[model samples]
Target: MLRELASILGLFRQPPQDASGGDRTLVAQLVGLLVEVRAAARSNKDFTTADRIRDRLSQLGIVLEDRPNGTDWSWD
Candidate 1:
């Protein structure tokens, strides 16, 4: 599950060779998709999957904030 999620989130993507980095818009979209998946897992009472998702993101330096409106994330 972890591997699948990581792959889907492009965690294995190669680092950009240029200083400009990669596409910010695409990165945001990918992160948003993962966040939605995490929300669905939580709503389904699948805390293990939710936690795994959060942990994996954290390992990538993405900090997640659970707000009343929704979950927000930022680079750590």
Candidate 2:
């Protein structure tokens, strides 16, 4: 979750002053789609698939912590 948020924020901040809002919208949409896919994988019992998503996010400096309630994430 945070990985994509960071990605979106990073994208939005890429421009010195005014960023292209279109890129931010696209980033948000993509992030939501990926998160839904990851959630579906977890719901389907494909832990390996879910872990792959988590690992990929981690590689991007985003940390994910799973709890009984849900998953929480942060970026370095």
Candidate 3:
């Protein structure tokens, strides 16, 4: 999953790790930011940006599931 995350976001100089050896907090925060941006783009009727975010995430094995209330995600 970290490999997949790296593929999607190569922003980290090195991926941060925690005691458990996976930085779940950082991952969630970063991905949550993307999700928020995507949602904002959708709300603004910017389908292109929203679709691009979704497609990129999908390519990285992340599945963004849209719901009436909000969006949910999981590793594919």
Off-target runs (Cα >4 Å) in candidate 1 are 2-22
What is candidate 1's CA lDDT for residue 22? Answer: 53
Candidate 3 lDDT for residue 16: 36
Instruction: Give the TM-score (vs. native) of candidate 3.
Output: 0.71
Q: What is the per-residue lDDT of model 1 for residues 1-76, given as tens digits with 9 covering 90 to 100?
A: 7668667766636442321335555666777988999999999999999998999988767789999999999877
Worst 10 contiguous positions by lDDT, candidate 3: 12-21
**Candidate scoring better on TM-score of 1 and 2:** 1
* Better lDDT candidate (1, 2): 1
The top-ranked prediction according to TM-score is 1
Error of 2 at 63 (Å): 0.5
Clash list (residue pairs), candidate 1: none
Query: Model 1, residue 44: what's the lDDT?
Result: 100
TM-score of each: 0.75, 0.54, 0.71
Order the candidates by lDDT, highest first: 1, 3, 2
In candidate 2, list every pair of residues with a backbone clash: none
Candidate 1 overall Cα lDDT vs. reference? 0.78
Better of 1 and 3 by lDDT: 1
Per-residue lDDT, model 3, residue 52, is: 87
> Stretches of candidate 2 above 4 Å error?
1-33
